[model samples]
Target: MTAIDTPNGMAEGTLDGSMAEFFKAQTRSSAPVMVNVRTLKRFPTAGCARLEATLIQDGVPTQQGSAIPFVIRYEINLCRDGRPPTEGIDLDAASRVLPR
Candidate 1:
């Protein structure tokens, strides 16, 4: 799969501040967290880019025994104006994605 770039054009896969705030609100956590962006694609025809990111919350111990913690799939779209298509993730929305 093609790695996604952050809104700031960083290849490190970290989400922007506003998006991070949105995620935090959704997750209801003030704990330190890290979002691993899996892919980012732009479609000139659609005039937007689809972003896929994974949310990881810190200090949440799981019973998997040193395994990965809870990982939630988050999808967001950046319009031609470089703003989120919506206030937050909506499962009903069809995210415009490029084939990996």
Candidate 2:
């Protein structure tokens, strides 16, 4: 996976487990999250696609009387193969916090 514009800068290659850890820390104090898919483009590979989405943290107002929710924009390359029980999936993603 290749992560660009991450909090810690760009990272490349297999993510192993660090990606989970990164997001876990990022959302540690946020409300329940929801993903809104903005776009999807299939790749030439049988089970691969590019996805763009917004991660919205509901119920978290940005201001005293505002209705804006916290949001993060991200794009990812996703691939899956094999059957469910033994299927393998890979992700290459980049994310950044969007300005309110």
Candidate 3:
């Protein structure tokens, strides 16, 4: 599934033209971003899991300086009925900005 977290909100599944524009408008520059997994937990039910991670954007440009950095904390819920060859995995994600 295609999932992306934008500054305005989260965009999931097949993105449309408007969503693409929103992403471009929100993220004007191509800043290097990295996803760092903080925790992973599996549910009692098979093929179910949850992940918590942070998206780090380093060396962001700002009016005061050009080295500003920020982090966005997010959680992803994933589940699948069978293996990849036969089944598909579903993903749902949400995110929030962490205070600097």
Candidate 4:
């Protein structure tokens, strides 16, 4: 399996600001956190890359706002990586990625 690029035109296995935000939201809490990204493919796969948020608060990350904490909102986006040019990751939708 190949690495996927961020929704934006980033190199394969890279995350943009929006992607970081999505990860934070998924984990919940505006406080900053880090994300380790790997392809949801194959068996016993290797991790692709790890992304750190630009800022952190109380061990959680806050947006790199201008002298203020930014509200964690969905207006943010997640860069999707795939072997080929795929649509993107739908965090709101569940992926049938695991065996039932």
TM-score winner: 3
lDDT of 3 by residue, 17-98 (tens): 6544454345453454554553255555555545565655555566775556756677766555432221232332212342
lDDT-superior candidate, 1 or 4: 1
Of the two candidates 1 and 2, the one with more favorable lDDT, higher being better, is 1
RMSD of 1: 9.7
Estimate candidate 4's RMSD in Å: 12.0
Model 2 root-mean-square deviation: 14.5
Question: Any runs in candidate 1 off by more than 4 Å, and if so which?
Answer: 1-31, 45-47, 61-68, 84-100
How do the residues 3-97 of candidate 1 rate in per-residue lDDT, one tens digit apiece?
A: 43344532334455887677656655555566665446665534456777676765444455443345677776666566655534563554555
Q: What TM-score does each of the candidates earn?
A: 0.42, 0.43, 0.45, 0.20
Error of 2 at 11 (Å): 27
Per-residue lDDT of 1-100 in model 2, one digit per residue for the tens?
1222233323333222555346535655334455455325555665555556566654544446554566788776655442222123332221234333
User: Considering lDDT, which of the candidate structures 1 and 3 is the better prediction for this target?
Assistant: 1
TM-score of predicted structure 3: 0.45
Q: How much lDDT does each candidate structure score?
A: 0.55, 0.46, 0.46, 0.37
| Candidate 1 positional error at 48, Å | 2.6
Which of 2 and 4 is the better model by TM-score? 2
